[model samples]
Target: MSDMEDCCDLQLCLDEIPSTFNLEKAVCNHGFFMMAPNSWIPSTKTLRRPLRLADFSASVVVSISQPPGPSSTVLLLRVHREQVIRMLRLSERDERNVKEFHKVHPEAKDRGFGRVFRSPSLFEDVVKSILLCNCQLSSKRKKRRQEKDGANPVPAEMEGEEVDLGNFPSPKELANLDADYLQSKCKLGYRTNYILKLAMEIEEGKLKIDGYEGVQDAASCRILIKGISGVGSFARASVLMCLGFYDEVPWDSETIKFLKHVHAREGCTKKTIKSDLKEIYDKYAPFQCLAYWFELLEFYERRFGKLSELSHTMYHKVSSSTQMREFNHNHVL
Candidate 1:
């Protein structure tokens, strides 16, 4: 069986490690890390961000045996360094990116914006972006009520469902599933067809979704994602950001809320958005996406507690409702 189909779990040992490898900072928020709240292993006061062997990519489950402390040597799941960089965006090589970002925003000198959470596959990133586009803040209280009632989105495997790979569904699995079953069970809404089409095309080898990894430019990535059904500008931007491009900051109602809450930028409209984003985040330049996300992480850390210490149940309360509205969404982490 391919790695995606086996139950094998392993630990990664690294030769060279980045100085900014804090597990607390890396897996801070469910939204930031793409990990389900329930999936995170617990931690006590002394030990933060306790090691857990959750799904890494496709079917490779491994744990980070060590946390980022005084040591320069980091331990991770035994994946290629390129794959690690693809997921966490952290490596010794990323020090330059972090240094450049800090040069623009001096306040972030100590804060670790070095890590940005992402999915194991570009397809998963695109799928989650579709879910994000459908999110609404119209009823925050109602969303919380659903979670409090134990109505959060369940992983495909946890839905009394099983496959050769007990993690995220492979494209073959997704392509074979009944469309109606995926929609109602996963609460995918109109995105069902979009996701299924992508899965089908990939499974048949008619579309080369994986090949985009070789395309180094974000603009090209955006164009590539735009071709998929139901992928709008926001979704494209989001997928690009996850692909480590950061060419644009995918803004939504949450962006408006954060700007008003933090920067006191009232009356931000479409005409004013460019200026607003520029004023607030342009200083971080090419790394503006990371800068914005780091600020969110910082805010959550102070308001809530360190995410590592919080139970997955409590984490569910704060995770995006949009995340809870999809099928197999939890597996995206």
Candidate 2:
């Protein structure tokens, strides 16, 4: 570790950033890591063969030929050496936001609240948000099919399913893909049209997806994001979360359930969701999303382990068996 400490040695350090940048909270920072396609191994925090933004010509390939284990973070990082550098661009705005957040919620200073996980490209984030809405049905179908075939039907990683957890297809790549191919191969369902429409828009210059990099106002940003076909309020909020805007909470059924079960609140229907959230978490101000997420992670860590520590097999078992308990014996005691 000491030998690899210099930025020049690894070519990973920005002018001021340290070699030992912390990624401990990345797994719990957002749903991207958890819901990511199979190429992303959550346990080790390794993205296999991610495409570098600098070079779309080919993926930054690295071999994971050996068996999975409780590999060191250093070992895992070797697999994504270049992509890590591209993903962690700490801008002045990000720094200011992080400092402001910690000042308001000093307790979250070390808990990784301010720094959320993001995809290497905005295009990836947009597509991932679409996938989040539709993939559950496909996963269910896969689960049923596996059961019928008497396959292990456990987590995909444990089965060593040799699928290409390939690079998130670029807009050009996606624009070229037909609807049938996206639906059949990517299991995108009806989301296939939305994704293709977005990709085509980008490809044709009707929408400047990269211009969103300068977006400052969350409300305006949400409006712009929601204009994408099939993007609803929840999906817009999620994309905002990934983009470092935490003012809006992505309140969907999962959010409602978590709020009710954890806060012991009743009568929290969709109509009253905003008021219910405000009553419980307005104290955190602009960083209310962080507060909600940290508490959620606390619940998950108690029931399982830190999500990043769970191996593929263990992750499947826990994800399948664990239900949210309003009052866990451990919490009560």
lDDT of 2 by residue, 1-333 (tens): 332231122323333423223545543445455443323455445544344334455554332322233232322343344345334435667666667777877777766556676766787777766555522334665465335435445445434444444455678877887788566554445777888999999999988877887788877787778778877777787788777788777777777788788987768889999999898778887877777777877777888877766554343433321111100111111
lDDT of candidate 1 over 205-323, digit per residue (tens): 87788898777777677778777887887787777777666647778777787777877888887668767988877767788877787777777778777766665445445666554
What's the residue-level lDDT of 161 in candidate 1? Answer: 35
Candidate 2: global Cα-lDDT?
A: 0.58
Clashing residue pair totals per candidate (backbone < 3 A)? 4, 0
Single out the weakest 10-residue window by summed lDDT for candidate 2: 323-332
Error of 1 at 173 (Å): 1.0
Leading candidate by lDDT: 1
TM-scores of the candidates in the order shown: 0.78, 0.74
Off by over 4 Å in 1: 1-15, 29-38, 44-60, 76-85, 91-96, 137-165, 323-326, 329-333
